[model samples]
Target chain A: MAYTKRIDGRKFNETRKMEAKVNIIKNADGSALFRFGDTIAIAAVYGPKPLHPQHLRNPEKGLLRCNYDMISFSVSERKRPGPTRRSQEISKVSEWALTPIVELEKYPNTVIDVHIIVLQANASTRCAGINAAALALANAGIPMKQLVSSVSVGKIDKKVVVDLIKEEEDYREGEGSTDIPLAFLSKSGEISLLQLDGKIRPKELDEAIKIGREASKEVYEIQKRALKAVGEEK
Target chain B: MIAEKKIIKQKVDEEREGKKKKREIAIPGEKIVSGKEYLPGDGTVREKDDIVARRFGLADISGRLVKVIPLSGIYMPRVGNIVIGRVEDVTFNGWILDLKSPYSSFLSVSECPRYIKGDLTEYYDIGDVLACKVVSVKHKSIDLTIKDRGLGKLDKGLIIHINSNKVPRVIGREGSMIKMIKDETGCEITVGQNGVVWISGSKVEDELKAKEAVLFVANKSYIEGLTDKVKKFFEGKRGGKK
Candidate 1:
């Protein structure tokens, strides 16, 4: 039973709708809220300030720290309040995804903390978190080479698709589903993050990345508009 | 020669005023301009033929230079910056000042000209606010000096904190905005590059008025006709007072 049609009727090269806003958190140095369909991610940036505990300070460059968490009420099954193993791993990967764009060398011995909270989750929460975190980092005025954009592309059976919804993720027909979440730097189109959750052939992964990169470009347009609109809004 | 220079200055000012209305804010990675004619300035980087913004702010073009004037960010400490800060800790030979910047700043007694007698705490105790000049800002160290006039202990005043990036707007062109606020409210306002402002006035009402004006300018830093708007703000306050 091959999964020929999309669960939501979206095109193979199409993504779930996305919404982005920046400077939403008042106290944070930078903050943003980004949404991909039902998944909602809010990110807050603090510092480039002095790092605590002393041990974590990087003498050569600043530290890029990320914390990603989904609220207890975000999912139907009720996520745990504290950090879990999966969230911890996501946090590490988000930090890695952000490090390429952020110029941490400018502030030596300091730490830039990015905290991401998922208010709702359907699928692709990590990608949405990265999106929000990128906006928040830019809003904080961190020196950066460029901005980052992320997308989650998956293959439902033989048909490779862009941005897999939860229903699509849960598809258990022929060949199951292969989830691939990716992040790309704006303009340069360099891959900063590439994660795979399911089995994928080398050829299929290449095609997924190609589709994901285009989808990320579209996301970049939305992110760019949101960033420009803020300083122009008076 | 002086008359000719004045005419040239006037023309420059007019050109700047005209350009303000069409000011565009550049986001990070956004290309400001292309070609060898324009040089990338602060907060901007040149990638091949294009000059893109490194910071998100107003894209300012002056002659052949392009720079992004950031609207908001933590203060990046630099040498030759006059900043206001509170004494966090009093040490043996120096004092630590919290300048609200990423880097920790220290004011050494050797840098202090008026350090003749008594303990360091006697001159600048913990929690004492001072207007100090940054003498040195190295990779791992920032040193402050109070060897000049108008740079020392702020005896009595109220402190207001704003985003460090808004300090330029509060100061304005040649201190025009600050002078306007001082004249309107009869207050002595000291704006710090680190965004800690000191306001001292004969009357509490005047001090508060000055604070309000400074905050107003900081909030609307990117707008055109800012001086005129600030004047109207003063007028509205006067009307309310009457």
Candidate 2:
């Protein structure tokens, strides 16, 4: 049977509820918390300070280093506490997603580190992590061209949708699940990150990109508000 | 869709300016003001007929210039700025000073007020704190000088740290806030541009009060009527002592 309706009783294009807040980690240069329904991610930013290891230093520009890890208890299935292969891959991708916006050339030989921790996982943990990382960078007052927002959008059994929660991701009927996580730059609306798992046709991928791009604008709105909220108290 | 985005942007800008009478907060890539009428200042960048914020900060618009006062960030060194640094190493020719920045600075013997007779440690020993001037910030190293007046090794007292961004408020307008703190607590206070503060007073109690006052100003740097509030705070503290 065709997937005519959302299993969760939501609109096809609707994302899960989201909340964003900034300055959560006091000692960190910058920090933020972002929640996408059941999935939650917290990120902290440090430096534009010196980078260790003589080889890693770039005299022409600075480096953007990211670490993404899910806590052991974040998922029902136990996750290893250390940097697993999956976490390492996500960390590298997160750096690429964030690097487009940072004015790296201004801080030559320094490194800005972004640490993203997934506290809870339903689905789209990387989505939440990327969103939190962007907010934390802005909170750190690192000069950036714009913010980055991410969302997962693809076919859950042959239907293009935005922000698939766990129930939707588990769909086993028809064409099965195709998860595509996408990141968009707030200013240029450019695609900085795009990753897909499972099978998808070229035409179906087009539909997913269209839906994901629009969904990311909502994430950008929340992130901007969170960054501006503290200063608005004045 | 692009045209529609422009309309939405116009609407948002209108709503922002309408509520903003004083103290507007700027977000990264957010337009501080549209049009070439305003020149972009520090913490801001120019973007196609609009002045945009490059950092998260307070939007300060005055006359023809628009700048953002950053609320948070590590200190970026600049030439001609006075900073407090701890002498990390007494080198063969100079002392390597830690300015709390990523880069370690050098204070050479030539930069000192007196000619070195013996070892460099004889002048400024390792582990000593000094208020020095930034003579140069080059690609490989930063240079410092102690020959400038009121810039030299600091003696015993207290050293407090605050965000470098709030150093302007700690000093106040024309040295007003710092002057008040010095007069009230009878402390010799030096506000460093790199956020390190040195306070030396006759009594330990006075030194602590001065430190508290400086922190108070740093904490409330964005608020209006800040000087008056600080004065009231001082009055209350003095009464508590009595």
Best by DockQ: 1
User: In candidate 2, residue B132 scores what lDDT?
Assistant: 96
Candidate 1 lDDT, A1-234, residue by residue in tens: 777678788889998889999999999999999999899999999998899879988899999999999999999998769989999999999999999998888888999999999999999999999999999998998888889999999988898999999989988888888898899999788998898888889899889999998999999998988888896577
Error of 2 at B92 (Å): 0.8
Task: Provide C-alpha RMSD values for all models, in order.
Answer: 4.0, 4.8
lDDT by residue (B109-201, candidate 1, tens digit) is: 888886357677778889999999999888768899999989999988799999998888899999999999999988998998899999999
Estimated TM-score for each candidate: 0.94, 0.94
All DockQ scores = 0.76, 0.59
Q: Which DockQ-derived CAPRI band holds candidate 2? A: medium
The docking quality of candidate 1, as DockQ, is: 0.76
The all-Cα superposition gives candidate 1 an RMSD in Å to the true structure of: 4.0
* Span of 10 residues, lowest total lDDT, candidate 1 chain A: A1-10
Residue runs of model 1 more than 4 Å from their true location after superposition = B1-21
Candidate 2 residues A1-234, lDDT tens each?
A: 889898778899999999999999999999999999899999999998888986999999999999999999999999878989999999999999999999999888899999999999999999899999999998998998888999999797778999998877888899988889999999999998899899999999999999898999899899988977887654
